[model samples]
Target: MDPVRTGGLRVVRAAVVLCVRAAPGTVALSFVMMFVGGVTPVGLAWSTKLLLDGITAGDPAGRNAGVAGLVVLGVLTALLSHVRRYCDQELSRRVKVRTQIELFTAVSAYQGLAEIEDSAFHDRLRIARDASEFAPVQIMSSLLTLASSVITLAGFGYTLLRASPWLAGLVLLSALPTLRAQIRLARRHGEMIVRASPFWRRQAFYAALLLDPRAAKEIRLFGLAGNLRTRMAREIHAGQAEERAQDRETLRVDLGLAAMTSVLSGAALAYLAARIAAGHGTAGDLVVLIAALAATQTALTSAVLDVATTGELITTFGHYIDLTSRARPQPRPVAELAALTGEIAFHDVWFRYAPGQEWVLRGLDLVIPRGRSVALVGENGAGKSTIVKLLCGFYAPVRGRITWDGVDLADIEPLELRRRIRATFQDFMTYELSAADNIEVGDIGGGRGRADLAAAADWAGIGETLAGLPRGYDTLLSRTFSDSAGDGGHEPTPGVVLSGGQWQRLALARAVLRTSADLLILDEPSSGLDVRAEHEIHRRLSELRRGRTSLLISHRLNTVRDADTIVVLRDGVVAERGDHAALMAAGGVYAGLFRLQAAGFADETVPR
Candidate 1:
């Protein structure tokens, strides 16, 4: 009941199913090829003895017959080898394709994007990815070689036994040392792969930046190609040096073992020759015995190698299973989000990132009524964004009661909760998607049609920017984005690039499209925009603020001075609470920060 034994049986069963389904002829041909290939070496070894005996006895006809048989067997061996290799390659290619398709589906189904960010998981995933994508062909080739080698060695062993039991013993001993050393090295190399996969992934990324066409402009403009190349070269050299050092040690051990095996086999051959000279054995018998010994070594060494490769292949193949298990989709319950009410409340919340950390939100209590705009003005490090993320259901507070219309957030599915909220982050992703698609992505799977796209664009001041696109709303954003819009048979084009401000507006537009959402959040939406653009955005935001509950996180106090409430955050704790006038009179954390800002615009004499 070992798990590996159970899984291996399953894998083998699946492989057999595929093999039988693909080509029944090829499967049968494998056994035929193994048998035919095995007979050739045995035939040649036996014929050598006959040829030598006929020559020694001065029989020209018998010698010619033996020579003719050896020639025929050699031809047969070549043809069988070719047929076996051809069939194995074809079968493996098909299996590889099937494996890759399944891997894609399994990995794509993963909902936990956070797991993909972990180093250990990434390393394991790379191994699975390679095995699913490329290992089928290798496993197939190894299996074929293993089959042919075993059959040939068994046939050769019989001939060796007929000549002398000592010859067969020598053949077995000769391959043991080589097989032991090679197998150890192969296993060690596999271990190295486990350790080196992550490093290699990083190196590959840097190398891609150096070589890829899309990265060429950035590389040249930033003068990063040489630096990246040097960094990657260092990693490659370090890995290669370690492997080479191991290889050198392995080589020394292997050579010493090989030398000892050769001496033992050579001594056995000398004994057989001496027997032939003493008339205990004929010259033909000695010749046949040596040939049989050589064939046995070839086949036995191959079999041992095949076994080692198969072990490594299976070990790596298990990674695919592990990755699949981790990525298994959870069957979450469906909840009604269509008839949502926008009441949100956070009560007595105490939060921390992990068990041992200090609490970020201690006894936090807040509420945003069915439809209203609230502002959280905080100094850096005040847990303002954490509050926004909590509302958006990206993360749950370690200890808190967040209610959606009197229903605790814990009772609702995370995805379903997110569907009722929309937000633009300070560090929002500038996806390499078309201008229109950028907005459409906010309500992804909703398929809200072209009118939704235009509405969102207008709300966020992106319509003016979209008008300047190369294809209006259909120019490819990223250089790597292929011109496949036409091939999709939808629009003439459906991609467009945008500037930084334009991208920010597009992100805003994306948030705007989630019109059905009860709650909306915007974190530092106008941070780096020009003065005119910032004011325009603030003006546009006023229209959006009506009749919808929102939480705005901003350092620009002027924009949120008109909020229903303004809570000051300093050092992850609330320091003050009041409107612009009330906070100015209180003269606490908010008062100091506001005075600092207002003084920047004061005249030199007037400030004092």
Candidate 2:
């Protein structure tokens, strides 16, 4: 067997196993019904022949018996069809749910961001998700249908062979070309879908942009709906072009196969007519020959179709198997992370986003001593975020190592290491949940009550605003959803959206809610606040930082002037490290940036 065919068989087997495990009773019942359904048509054909012969011979009892048998079989077949349909739908639903859950679970288990950040992986993921939705069930259904068709073909073939072996052989042989054509078409269809996925993804992106509330404001402001619509249409056209070409090829091949079968049927009919004209065949023989010839062709065609459809479905489902089967990197033998008693140190760390990319951090060495606040100030693209990601263990160093106290970060369990750290990122999430729920999300497993949530909100300077909402802490914080569940039979109100600064404050409350965290990191924590609000929030943060190990990254020099140690990052290395006054005296990059920002605030012009 061909390697591709062998792989397809394996996928088919896996699909069978998955469906059986998902709903074994449904699978067994469906197959049993299919078998009965397959044999019913054969029974109907034989009964029609018996009825015709009984009428011709004036046998009234025989004709009546044939009529009764036909009626019973017809009703049974109809009932079986309905039951089979229900079973197929139930099996499909169960399998879809199982596959989707397993798919996402595997996705979430990925221990690194490298694969998640990959563009090609995104395409594969999208395809795999689509395959998960239907492929397994479709493959199983097709396989069962193929088996049913085979049973039908065997019965019809026996009838035809009894009438004339030559006719039966010719009818069976005609299906070979169709079977070959359908296999080719299936392969082409699978390839076309893979080729067109990128276009479909882009089309989906444009479609989503048109519907997104965030983009709606900018789109209307810039008058961009027409341009976006045009781009979306272009992607649709690109993808459809591939499909249309394949469809045309499929049509041509089908027409040729149809013509061949039609010619064979005509020849068989003429031969049967000559046998009857020569007085060598009875009226019943004529009826049986006509029915069996047509039935055999139909059964063979149906069988070929089921096989083709199964092949196509298996080809697509292979993507899901490939994605889920990929082995995750095993963790090295390491102990649980210990408390941060001494310092977090980066020793000669070097990193790049990918191979051949420009290095983001080059031979960088830094440290945050225990119970001391360290503020990292840098210009944009000075690797501030990269360092944060590295420290959070989202990525590892390309060459050097980071350590907790003296133990290498790579030697500590990732989950255990992260549980001791808390950070309010510059790009923190603003969840569309209740105000209290948003804060609670930060330390979900911490089991804190509403009072603890309120305290954290107060620490972030957002307690009063949240408390003033109509439903207090339970109020939904988004305009996207309405509070439709009424209280006391009264009409409910809609939720409200917060301002940027308010959302920022809420995110801060979320991070601060994790009071047990050992190392606190604040990245531009007051960037969205007004002047007075920023001043007030920074004062609270300064107090929060007192006698605690913290790392702060801020572009505002005034905010870090009172830190225990301020580190200036320039060219991916520490340019200066000391107290604010010491760095200002040194008058290096940090001093120049501070004076420049001060000039802007003092209403004095500064040369570029």
Best by TM-score: 2
> Candidate 1 versus the native: TM-score?
0.79
Q: CA lDDT, every prediction?
A: 0.74, 0.87
lDDT: which candidate is best?
2
TM-score of each: 0.79, 0.94
Per-residue lDDT over 476-556 for candidate 2, one digit per residue giving the tens place of the 0 to 100 score: 887778877687674777887889999899989988888888999999999999999999999999999999999999999
Instruction: Give the Cα error of residue 363 in candidate 1, in Å.
Output: 4.9
| Model 2 regions more than 4 Å off | 1-6, 327-332, 485-492, 604-608
